[model samples]
Target: MYNSDTTSWQEVLAAFKRIWGYDDFRPPQGEIIRSLLEKHDALIVMPTGGGKSICFQLPALLQNGLTLVISPLVALMENQVQELRDRKLPAALLHSELPTWERKKNLQNLEKLRLLYLSPETLLSAPVWEKLCQPQLEINGLILDEAHCLVQWGETFRPAYRRLGAVRPALLKSKPAGTKIAIAAFTATADPKARATIQKVLQLQKPAAFQISPYRQNLHLKVQTIWTPRGRRQGMLKFIQARPHEAGLVYVRTRRDSEELTELLRQKGYATAAYHAGLSPEERRQIEASWLGGKMPFVVCTCAFGMGINKPDVRWVIHYHSPLLLSEYVQEVGRAGRDGKPAEALTLVSEATGWLNPEDKQRREFFAGKMRSQYQEAQAIASKLPTQGEVATVAKQFRDGAIALSLLHSAGQLEWQSPFHYIRHQSGKSCSFGELNAQQQQFQTQMTQYLTTRECRWQFLLQAFGFAKEAAGWRCGHCDNCN
Candidate 1:
């Protein structure tokens, strides 16, 4: 390992310039890179243009073996891998989009590479884990990208992520003795609880958590209340007209909202595009590229558009509707002002829909029902596992039991009898009148304050998430209420 402190900032600069030809580090980048080199577990909360990638990528280059990056988005992994390879850095990604031959070849090349990115979903697969654990491939470090998702915001019951704790132990068991693996978890949004969850879920050992304030002095946050849907359209138009030709993002609550707003903005003479999960992958990428490349001055999108997005110089970010949670609100707005220049965040809030968007509401219901059914099926399967061979019995019984328990526990439909045992839904524990409702109501109250309060949005958010606020009250000055 390089003696990080003994290595002057000049040596780091020369090495970076020699490889990527950069003369200096972005603000905070040097501190983070130094932390990584010193073998400390770091929790990095860097906004879009805070130079997050270089913080990790540079360390990967300086390190001896492969750095395993656990990314959630397929496109994100592909983009990073391509960029690294372009820089002549040895990098590869294992994702579902890869063909069989390519995936196998990438796995074979793991020993020769400096970085390997894999989605948590792919890493959770038993077959993939088996192959990766074979004597040849030993990970030197682990990076969890979009690390906040390991908590409930991105994963309400993401089974794959829950399994990662066990996977880490399994990985450690297979690696050679004296192998010291460093893990760093990075995200754009993580409140105190989410940060804790990320550390626990990733099984980090006394991780050093570093959080840059989400407040950007360059971005203004505004919330305007509209009484009707028709009023929202007029509000959006007015907001867009206020600043023409500057790049911006408009976030809507639904896919249909994205399509309609895109058309509305175009009719108003602004170059625009719509993006959401409902669109085909190709279509989404095209829209994203258009917006990022400055071909379109604005993009009407769902919350899915901003994760790991590197587009800088976004002049504004407008939320056409309210988000369900405060964490999400922080993430969407953080996308702007990432270039360290002034930007704006305008949220057009209407009277709450009571969560009535058919698609959003139905998807939650559908997933809940599916989890219940899967739980029952897995329970039956586990009961039938024979007490015979160690590997087969343990795999069949332990996995099924773990899955059944985690799903039910997360869904709030089961009460723990012991660590290994659980009982069925009691009245208070069921969905109708349970802990779930209590938590949902609490978050709703937080959202209400977010939209209605006269206080600075940054201060409001920090308090809502149980973070310590600065003594000056508002840390950053560019938010709507501050201005």
Candidate 2:
């Protein structure tokens, strides 16, 4: 175990240069890393290109015990773990896709790891959770990578995320005394509301915060209105044609859209592919490798495409359809111009109304309907929920009962005692379809407002992300409306 308390900044730089061959830390990187080494909780938000990973990774290596990184994506975990292992760093990742032998081996070696990456689900799985609860595991910190996912998906499909705030406390309860477990949430995109939610949900204890503005001078933003679906196709094609062989990503809302658009582009003699969660892990990796390797110019994909990808020279990003949230828009577009060169983010929209092209509105309606149905399902099962029980046991007895409990927990109608155990209140607080759908409605409205706003695109994004001071009376003079 390294003596982090007496470690000098010079030694930190030596390790950085020796391992990653870097000489300096980005602005707040040094501060964030210092906070982690000192065992202080922190919330870090740097833009996509800002060396965010080094801030935690290096500190984890300098620490005494294992630093558990809770990430949202399997591909991201695998990519990061592979990179560390390639450097001969004592890092490992555990995911469901691992073969039995590999998984068993990882479990056996958990105590020896310096840094371990796993999804929130994997972290809470019985095998991993039991091992973590062991008094001798000697955990030092918890790192939440791509933390915006906790706020974005915690209340929705990925209920496992909602249970994370309890993780540190619950594990500490069974661990040996004097085990200090600090937590840090790291993300490239998070708004003021999202930040507040993360702080509250994680029970962060006066965490040291570092937030950089999402504004990028080199990334030009644009939004075009198209009256027809074919016009939408044409707009994207024109943008790609203008770029002429530059690496980029075309963002879509669904898997079907990814495939359909990829097919259309490929028919036009473009070297492109569809990327979405529907593809097998091997298939996804192949596409990711091809794109990153520059064999494929660009790929049409859903929001799942860009978390751990370190492609620094992505020249452009086009949104075939507007995302439901501004944070998502910022994250996707932020993927471009990472090399500090000029990049362009173009968004194509249907008319202000859905008269000629109805995809955007249809998607909103579809998503809203689904949210309402989910709320009703949870509402129906609320009364039948037990006061306290294992989440998995309830899942076996009732369909979607685990998810319902999750949603109830989100609404203050129930509580998760631990990732595996939950407790529902007998009476008092009640949840509603309307109450649960409120946040989604707000997100839908914000995206629509962004699509139709006549203001500078960069300014709108900056202001949307709680950078009002930086955005004050500022204009890039290059965005669609600015021009």
Candidate 3:
């Protein structure tokens, strides 16, 4: 292992230049890297384009053993791994999408790997977990990329992340004595509550946290409330027409919306395609490649479109429908103007009234009720679950049972043995169903308020994400409200 205490900053700088060709480190990149090299866990909450990747990537290269990056998306993992491989760095990824031969090859080459990326789901799978637990393997660090997903999706969409808190201890049991592996989580948008959730979920110990303000002066924020479906479509068309051939992305809430809007734009002579999770991996990759290579001018997509995509010249982003959460809104819009040039983001919301748009309120209420039911269901099942059992075993007995286990883990009623297994820590303990429900309602209300606010959009976002001090006495003249 590299003795970070004895290593000089000159060596670090040299490695940085050799790998990334950057003459100097960004503001907190150096500090964040040092924290990891010294084996201190960290949580980084820099805005998009703030050079978050380098903080972990650079240190991984400088370290001896492998760095395991737990990312949420397969595309994101493949993108980063491919970039590293292109640079002749030792990087590989493991995911279910890989062909049989490719998966075998990656597993065989694990010992030669410097950085390995995998989704939380894949990392927790039996095959991968067994390989990682082998005593001969040495892991330098674990990185949770796009860490806010742990907070956003842990309870519902992906429960494997909730069990990650147990990973360190379980892995330690198999490793040689005194083997220490540091952990670091990186994200573009995590408020105070989300940060706390990440720390608890990942078992980060007194982690050195680095958070930058989410404000971007170059990205103008705007919201328009359309009273009818036709009006919304027309408004979107007008917005797209105003931009012409510039590269941009149109975000919709569902696959149906993506398909419908793509056809509408195609009929209007726009070079575009629809992208959603419903497409096969090859199809998604083709669309992504075409968009990235400039063959396609724009894409009408669901939220699955742009996580780790580094398109600097994207001039605009339009939300055909308002996102359910402010975090989603901030992340989706932050994709534009990454090159620090002027860009625009506009969200089309439904006008709140009986006749024109009942779907918006109905959707919000449906989601809120779904969340409440999930919490209630989790509480009900907590008593019936075994003290120690595999996740798959318990999941077979109930619908969305993985989510139930995750909620119990979060509320301290259970503990994970690994991603796929858990141990009941406290039987018959009441999980904080009411508290979680209230928090969910608050988050929904905040998004609704953001759509209706007449104040500076950026200011509203900063305040919403727990940056009250920064939002105070500040106004960006670029936003619609400020203008």
Candidate 4:
């Protein structure tokens, strides 16, 4: 009943009103939707709460074909799919944790779906890929939500993401003639480098690019230096006590920190929970539900707590420890003040020198050390990788082989042949050392600058994120520095 022809704008409005109880689209959202409906490729870089989901979801609902959204986190996919199903919309998700019968049922109903959300790894799995490539399946588009993960994790951690560039072409080979699969990538925080990487990797064709600056005027930012670990605990407790009824999140860098902070908060008579990747999916779900449902006022979580979880009225976010990357900081803080109300973000760090507590510096060095070791492993395996083969078999054949292969791909010595295969360059050279290390150090330096800068917090962020014109003489009077 919905179509994207010239007159489809009216249809879009009608659907929006009927389904979402809304009257309009955000800036560039209508334009982005129009482009995708016309089978045009697009790259969208709007920040969080900019209605990024609606831009893709609405178009998918209006089309006859299916839109595959490759997202990073399981929680994210489930949250979105559940929301759509509540609206009686045709959206479903597939992930590792789904029950066998449910997975089978979803697959059997694939053709009935307007949107299907999955991880890049799940998308390229044998059964999933086989079904999607069926000559009868009509995939209208491939979208990368949280597209920055393709840069953040694809290179070293999750190699399947590195092969996504080859997905569209492979799917089209089995599709009927006159079928055009428009490709689009959506992300909340992609720097110029990340944007270029996403475009180059996904091979988007002259996409309609929509970029919104990563500046949130509603979020008040501040950084507090604590001289001792005990002081850090006190600061956290104090921050929580001051906002007794407000819901918020405390971002930490480790699982242990998440749990310890959770205990500290609980002992202070606050309802809180710990969240990290190590928890069972069910446990994670309960915690997510508690916080989202307002049974818990806050959560102490690692980076795993992000992507696809939506709560508009979060009044604050405190970085229990400094993030090692500025992009990460922006993303976590963007989660707050999404309802257009005032929100606070307080980042706690150690004193200028590491004498009192070198925890932050120690963490940065440890992270760098891990990257350096991965580089060494990749270099050792580059000349030894099979000329061409499936990544799963390679992973079984050698230790950390998949990770090594991904590192080599990111270093330019290897290229993806398909979603599950690769071709090593016969240049007779191993992956050169220090490239990944150097990149890691550069990111660390940028994050350090953000933490130590004397400029207005938002101004520093705007300038760092490539909106120099807007950052020029821009200062929010509410930031800690200004106050």
Question: What's the lDDT of the predicted structure labeled candidate 3?
Answer: 0.87
Candidate 3 has which clashing residue pairs, if any? none
Candidate 4 residue runs with Cα over 4 Å from true position: 1-6, 426-433
Quote the lDDT for 289 in model 2: 95
Which pairs of residues collide in candidate 4? none
lDDT per prediction? 0.71, 0.87, 0.87, 0.87
Q: Which stretches of candidate 1 lie over 4 Å from their true place?
A: 1-10, 153-157, 266-270, 352-433, 465-467, 475-478
Q: Can you give the lDDT of residue 364 in candidate 1? A: 40
- The residue-by-residue lDDT of candidate 4 on 276-377, one tens digit each, is 999988999999999989998888999999677899999999999999889889999988999999999999999878888988878888998888888888
Clashing residue pairs for model 1: 221-480
Clashes of 2: 0
Worst 10 residues of 1 by lDDT: 385-394
Candidate 3 residue lDDT tens string, 240-265: 88887899999998999899889988
The per-candidate count of clashes, in order, stands at 1, 0, 0, 0
**Per-residue lDDT over 188-268 for candidate 1, one digit per residue giving the tens place of the 0 to 100 score:** 777776777677666688887677766566777788767666777888888878887788888887788788878877787
Q: All predictions: root-mean-square deviation over Cα?
A: 5.5, 1.6, 1.7, 1.8
TM per prediction: 0.82, 0.97, 0.96, 0.97
TM-score of 4: 0.97
